[model samples]
Target: MGEIDTERQKLNCFRMRELGATVVPVKSGSRTLKDAVNEALRDWVTNIRTTHYIIGSAVGPHPFPDIVRDLQSVIGNEARAQMLNQTSGEFGHPTFTNGPGRLPDLVVACVGGGSNAIGMFNAFLEDKEVRIIGVEAGGEHGPWLPDGSDTDKHSATLTKGTVGVLHGSRTYLLQSPDGQIKETHSISAGLDYPGVGPQHASLKACGRVEYVFATDQQALDAMRTVSRKEGIVPALEPSHALHQTMEFAKSLPKDKIVLVNLCGRGDKDMLHVAKARGVVIDTDVKLNKTDFAQQ
Candidate 1:
């Protein structure tokens, strides 16, 4: 799966259990997505005859990358067809008679593990004219800093990490001197990662795709903006996309057509956000830094 979120995984497990699915807790490593994936892989290897490994992201083993790309192409295909239909209706010209169709001028998506961006970009990969922008969380480190200037405090790995193997793919990773995975932190839990998808790394290397950083403040502000303007409380991940979109809109021509992925909802982050804002949760409980840290 994408950079696994332990917080989301707990909620997923609870929901699965409620649906009568047997949930096996994987207790190893950091007891996070990486560990859970390793445990699942072991189980799949031992029970290949009966077990299924539900791979996430488009960068897994051979068939998985192709399979996921094909599956994700539907989003682009449908979107293309829909946009064509809308354009034809608006311009009063049938699709075929209107000559070659115009591709979307711009496509934007937030990249956590990069599945959605891959899926969306796959739709227009051959177009050669459309621009694809992937928004990544800037983490604690500010953007545009020179490489190696970043201390080990932030998790904006895509911009600062080295190429390596992570999760089931060869990608970019944040590692220590001995190559051990380093801990990462982000205000947006979804975009908090120690690595990026291999596809994204390759694209970045080739300059086929452009990556932008949306800081926590930008994402939080975008979240509030969308909530007020569109009445949509977007997930923190996609809020990053919105942040980029707003920036693009300001710089680009007005006629440019920009499509963005909203990704998921934001309900899961309320507690984390409330705590960050010092909203005084659990008023009956009080503790010093040592006790708080222990908890």
Candidate 2:
């Protein structure tokens, strides 16, 4: 991961290390997702025989994206099965159905590299009645430009990027007219990227899936909403999806069901969220005798 994300996402990195994985922090360029991916690709090519590049998201070249989507498809498979198996008493009897009975009117997920969204959408792709939506991070920008000219303030690749090649894949990318990759921003560390997966580009081109963006403030608000109302603290990545899901749900009838993929937990994002919201956490505060005694 990049140096910035390595620090912001320290808990996950530490957990990976505890599980016997070597976490390499790339300290070059913008020190963000794009730079990290570039470094990983460089290392993989140099030590092809000794290293296996297991990409976490559904980005990169052909086979890798396919592999990731296939592996992560378990999410969609399980969701679809659970939704369709109302007869088996899972999810109980639904108030509405997809003609065939008990299917989501909408399937939504947050799209950084699009692994999770692709995984969830794969199972429902054949179901033409299912409306699939992918949400991207809008950063601090209130709304993204249609032509992708404003690249620095948002990671809304599918929403605002131009078609270009990045990380060995032809996809929508935040780049300059000279084809140089541009910097992207998002409150969510995981969704800060310049390019999306090739499959997502194809989906966008074919109009099979709808791609939208949620602003940083909207996502933060949604995170708090879900945390307080549903007792589920979602990671910043999935909060974008939840924000869009809430907006989309309002237009639907009472019987319709919208499914949003909560792909990560908020445990890894607590500090980042606090800092973004201007809440200072004094980690260096000296413990009093009472504090030690409570522990």
Candidate 3:
């Protein structure tokens, strides 16, 4: 049903296994999100007759990003409607909570092939007063230069990559002149991708939106900060947005409203987070041998 490699994702694969789902493991590259995506596509080709491949990101073949964007637009629609609703409350308007916009002055989401970010931004695109931001994985460094003079260990595609075709879509991708996709890294498996959705590329190019990055450490720290302040544990991906949100919000008055999409739960990331912190989590919960067998 899915391809996973990180010990954290492996644990979830095991859980899905208990439900009798066929989960595959991708063992190449960084053994992270990118490898898993490749394995899943291979599996789809092998069982074309009986399988329907639904990818998680807003990337891949044309119409795929558009399709997923439509499906996920509910996130944006609801956020917009809710903001309007809040404005009708006791304060008589959101001005006391945010800036002059009927919608949020700023909306932020982490971009991994950009599904979540696009989903949260679609409804606000026409609202020029509402600014949207997409945050990319900063990997080892947020904005690493690729001139051979700086270390290359980040997935800040919009912030650092060049245009290239990838997964049937022309978008910003980390690639060489030979058109080979380069390896991407991110502590968040979800954001470990070299190519981003084409629409995200368009949005950035036309200046309809802004793109930024949060380093692995920055995301992790945001995860910890949100957990402590809001009692909510967020996945590493969207923690990038939170990191940016906290940074910007702190400089503004209490009246300003900044929305950060807390996209996923942190439950799937505990093992990885612990490992990153040099904490060894010794869990040997075994499952059937065939649970991880390729389909």
Q: List, residue by residue over 1-295, the lDDT tens digit for candidate 1.
A: 3223545444555566789987665566645445555677788889999988775656555566667766776676656655555434332334433322456788899887677777887767677888989888886554444674665555566777787777667877878767899876667756766777677888898988888887877888898899899988888788889999999989888777888878777766655556556775563566789997997
lDDT of 2: 0.89
Write the residue-wise lDDT of candidate 3 on 118-154 in tens digits: 9999988999988788999988866555554554588
Clash tally, candidates in order: 0, 0, 2
Q: What is the TM-score (0 to 1) of candidate 2?
A: 0.89
Off by over 4 Å in 3: 1-4, 86-101, 145-148, 285-295
Q: Report the Cα lDDT for candidate 3.
A: 0.82
lDDT of each: 0.71, 0.89, 0.82
Ranking by lDDT: 2, 3, 1
Q: Return the top candidate by TM-score.
A: 2
